[model samples]
Target: MAEVNYKQDMPPKGGYAPIVFQNIPVKKYFNGYTMFAGFAAITSFSFYMYYQNFKRRRLLKIERQDAINALEPILLAERDRSYLKQLRRNVEEEAELMKNVPGWEVGTYYGEPIYKTVPKEKLLDPILEEYYAHTSEKAYDDKANEFLWR
Candidate 1:
């Protein structure tokens, strides 16, 4: 009887080499103008947005003031003296409160006031008061009706 030996599992027959791996470092390339162009674009966009905001806010403020001016005479005539007086006080208080706020000058590049340097004491100025006082009954009626519809 012959005994079969399976000790080394057929052993190594040839010179077998292992696979070698090489790592190559890749260098990143960028254009010189790319960074500057990006910065310029961001700065320009930011400036444009700020300018637009200033213009819009200034326009809104003017529109609001104009509307209030237009309605002043009618409201004063229709409402009682006490109520008008109270309303004037409230408006002045609000203006004072908003005076110190940032962007108070809104669109002014030099931070100057829209109108005069000094603020008006009352919402209804002497001009409007005089206009209402001197207006005839027919003209007053016509103006009041026009304002009401507007």
Candidate 2:
């Protein structure tokens, strides 16, 4: 509880410390033009970003509308065709169930085993193997199998 000497730590001649930039005294004053320029820049940037976002959304909406308009008819036609195909399939399935075809038992089994199964030695021929591989991977053949009897 002795008296605290606060005067000794302070500069001998001090009211407030002067701000110096590279040894030059900086005047403490607000530059209205600089503040205004900064505010304008920030506001303008925000507005520009908002405008770009709006423009992008509008363009995407237009593109989506265009795609829907263009593909709507084709999609409708495909839907109708698929429905007809399904109906035909249901009818055929019902008939097959009633008649109970000898070789058409319902099971997880795929198409019949290859009767003319190629020998392992035959697969060693590069030309024959390549041809068989190409035929096995044929897109049209795969798709055709979906609608045709094996």
Q: Using TM-score as the measure, which candidate wins?
A: 2
Per-residue lDDT of candidate 1, residues 42-104 (tens digit): 999999999999999999999999999999998888766754664556456556756878766
Residue 99 CA displacement from its true place in model 1, Å = 54
Residue 83 lDDT in model 2?
53
**Sliding window of 10 residues with minimal summed lDDT for model 1:** 122-131
- Candidate 2 lDDT tens digits, 1-150: 899867557765657677665776689665999889999999999999999999999999999999999999999999878655654554456456646555543221233533246653342223333223323456445655656765
Best by lDDT: 1
lDDT of candidate model 1 versus the reference: 0.66
C-alpha TM-score for every candidate: 0.32, 0.43
